[model samples]
Target chain A: MANDPISQFQIKNIVPIEIGGLDLSFTNSSLFMVATAAAAAGFLFLTTANRGLVPSRLQSISEMSYEFVASMLRDGAGSQGMRFFPMVFSLFMFILVANLFGMFPYFFTVTSHIIVTFALAMLVIGTVVVYGFWKHGLHFLNLFVPSGVPGLLMPLVVMIEVISFLSRPISLSVRLFANMLAGHITLKVFAGFVVSLGGMGALGIGGAILPLFMTVALTALEFLVAFLQAYVFAVLTCMYLNDALHPGH
Target chain B: MFVVTPAYAESNPTEGTHSEAGAPGGDAHGGGAFPPFDQSTFASQLLWLAITFGLFYLLMSRVIVPRIGGILEHRRDRIAQDLDEANRLKEEADNAIAAYEQELAEARKKASAIAETAREKAKAAADAERSTSEAELAAKMADAEKSISAIKAKALGDVDAIAEDTASDLVKHLLGGSLTKAEVAAAIRAASGK
Candidate 1:
């Protein structure tokens, strides 16, 4: 179908999916989310199943992934923050795998949706808040109150801090969603050019070849961006956690 | 541009059917259709978060951390063992040096004692030789004195004998031949200095 590319993002109602008249559509987005989770679990399981002194290929990859995340957490958050390594590592792998999976022809880009990205961002921010409170109690609020500030500027500083705090989720979610959506849109636009021009005469077809090359180039660049975005998300999460742990510093 | 028109036509059919069947609200199939916020999605997200957190925590705590810790502990043990061995070697070297010093002192003492003993023996031997030489010289002087006295006695005796013989010969001559031996001796005594 000509519309299949756009329709890939559509929500299809499945058996009403209701416990008590709640219209919960098991949409294409939901299906992709489940697929992403299953794939993540299977990949980790397969890679880590055979633990050996000398590593196989899969084991090497798993070990490398482990070291990568550990180093990142240690570098960004220090030894005291090492306890958060697992959460940050999982978040990175999950998002990276999901983004890569979405690049396939039949797959849906779950990160392109605002709700999914927002949910992930909220979780990271919420963890920072909750962990801060749990660890430091009411003293965590000292993060807003800058030390050595003049009494007159205290209130202004606190207001700025609160505004910055509230904007965290928006920035986090928007960064991921915007990147995913823009990359997909650009890819689609380029692909459309190639397909349309290729159907014309030889001169038009010749013109289409350039777009095809550009699409390939852009796709490769998108892959790199996908990996970088995951890394950025995980590193930022660690930094936020660090802030929560050591507030005023 | 030609591809865009065809894509719009294909998407429009689905939009028409969706609007006709659904409630009279905002367009569900519009270009900017955003799903309404549902609180239930939070529960799903939370569930996923919990599952992932638990699984990852278990992997890190039970599997990864322990392995790394074991490696570190083993390295520490090896280093400690090497240090202990080095210390032992150092102690052994110290002991050997101490032993060598002790033996050297003992040899010096023994050497000095032997030299002193040898010096005493040499002095005694020299003293004994000197005493023996002095005794031999005294005996030789005594023997020479005895020989000189004997020679002096013997010469005196010989001188007395010769004087007697000469006096007898002079008396015989003074007696005028062989008259009477008694008368001749008397005459010689009278003439000699009476």
Candidate 2:
């Protein structure tokens, strides 16, 4: 019972609330989300509060993250995409901080859930669609029609393009969701192995060493995935935003 | 950290039992769906995610992004200004060096000119002094020659008179005869002439 891996992902209510028959109770998920936002915002605000010409250690970190996202956007979306800098930066920092927060034991991984990731993905895709239409009107549909497709296969190619385009949100959301979920489950399972095996005698303790090592290794890998997923998410967001900015190609 | 997970699990034994027992026919959260896929908590999770993410975006757009961006922009401007100042100072220094070199060259030229004029003046003065001394020496030599000629002439005149008196005395002593002064004079004159 104490070794149930799935229990960690349970959304236990912290402050149960009933409003209009909707279950908007603040759960552990919400707590971690709030924590992630606070950590990200608070760190940036505090570190750059002084706004030194030469940044301090903490300040350097803040500046590095800023430059990192800025350059990522500039590269992925070009100069025109700079208008979306705030959104892209916000997404990047939120995911990065949330994923790091999830790395802690007993902490809820906000990104581990599909609905949350889907919402975030939809936010990006929605921005792209709205902004694309608003900025370029129906011309944004040119994205589905490749410029060099032959006349006969044009419809077939566009159909493929449309299907692929629709899959962007799903892939974006699922990639992060699946990675976080799978990594955490794997880590938990191996950790469970260590516990179950160690419960036996000295022979079992010796046998548990392998899973213990694996668990340790997996934890390190999970940390990498945490940071990597955040980066991939931000990069993909930039690319999608790029599509919105220049939908023709 | 590992210890914390088990302790956490122990504290939430209900959730653990619920998942294990109700894997087939899970209840609200655990009966049918995985915890992440559980539709029951979707609204709440979405609400909080929206709330926190929206606030985060606002903070970033309103305060944080601008602040960091301003810092970067300010640093870039400062560096550019510093580089400009450095270039200006270097140009000024180069100009100063050029001016100093030109002044040094001019001073050297002026000094040589002064030295050349001084040398010419010294040489001219020496030549003038030499010519004046030579003129004085020539005048002195001419005067000495004039005086020597006069002395010679006077001695010659006295010698003539003495020679005549001596000749008369010799004739008187030799012949015991007195000759007249005019005759003696004539005789001496004739002798001189002969």
Candidate 3:
């Protein structure tokens, strides 16, 4: 029972607080999210504290990450994308740090949960919606109306675009949540196999070898997935920002 | 260190269902899957996420990014200044080199002109000395010629006297008292065509 793979994701309330029938207690997820935030801030602070001309290793990394997102925004959304750099950069740092931290043995993975990921996804889509409408007014609806479509097929295409636009948050949040959830679960399952197999005799220990190797391999894969997921998130955010900045196509 | 409250652990409502189901899809959040699907905890996670995200964004955009940007800008300015200074110094050096070369060429020209004038002066002095010595030699040759002419004239006069004595002596021997001195003198005057 204690080795239940799904049990790893159960939220335990460390500090319980109820306000007007709303559960606002700090759960294990909140604890790690706070920790992730602190770590992200601390990292930025430490790396940039001494901005040397000939940069130290950490300073270069700080600058490189800054440039990385900067270029991404520039390339994906053009000059107009610079406006949202703060939000996108902050999101990148937070998700990247949180995902990497979750790779540790006992750490809670905040991004693995749908609630947290959906909130972030909502934030992106909300910004896109609000900014697009604020800046472009009714012309922002052109985002859903593809240009140059035949009138006969326009109705169908518009419906499809509308559905897809509405599903942005769902898809965005689910992609990250599912990837993290599946990868971690698979890793945990393999680890369980190794434990159960090793509990048997010498012959069972020999069988456990395969699962151990798979677990190690999966850990490496999970690390790659962590980085890749963060990259995908940032890139998609930029693409969404592009739609808002240059509506229509 | 984590302090586990005894009351919290004892009254966990969702514990039995989670361990029993072992399925991420078993809880009400089962469809959503996992802890986030657990509706009881959604508000807290979202609330904390919002708070933390807002704080992080503010700190990153306002504080950290500007500090790094400022440093980068300062360094860039410094580098530009260094480059400009180096260029100015290089131009100054080039001008100095050109000036030095001009000075060197001028010195060379002055030296050659001095040598040329010295050579002309030495040649003129040599020519003057040679003309003066030639003039002195001509004067000496003229004086020697004049003295030789005087000697020749005097010798001729003595020769005439000697010749008359020899002739008188020879005549006395031949015709004992040949002729008197006046007669000889008249004979000599007639022979010289006086």
- Name the lDDT of candidate 2: 0.89
Off by over 4 Å in 2: B1-32, B148-194
lDDT of 1 by residue, B21-69 (tens): 3323334335323222323333333444445545654655566545544
Better TM-score candidate (1, 3): 3
Give the winner by TM-score.
Answer: 2
Q: Which residue pairs in candidate 3 have backbone atoms (N, alpha carbon, C) closer than 3 angstroms, thus clashing?
A: B29-B37
lDDT of 2 by residue, B16-108 (tens): 453443232335664334578777677788899999999999999999999999999999999999999999999999999999999999999
- Over the stretch A21-85, how does candidate 1's per-residue lDDT look in tens digits? 33344555656666776676666666665545456787667667767877888888888888777
lDDT of 1: 0.71
* Cα lDDT of model 3 by residue, A79-126, tens digit: 889989888889888999999998999788999899899999999999
- TM-scores of all candidate predictions against the true structure: 0.65, 0.86, 0.82
For candidate 2 chain A, the 10 contiguous residues with the lowest summed lDDT are: A1-10
Best by lDDT: 2
Report the TM-score for the A-chain of model 1: 0.93
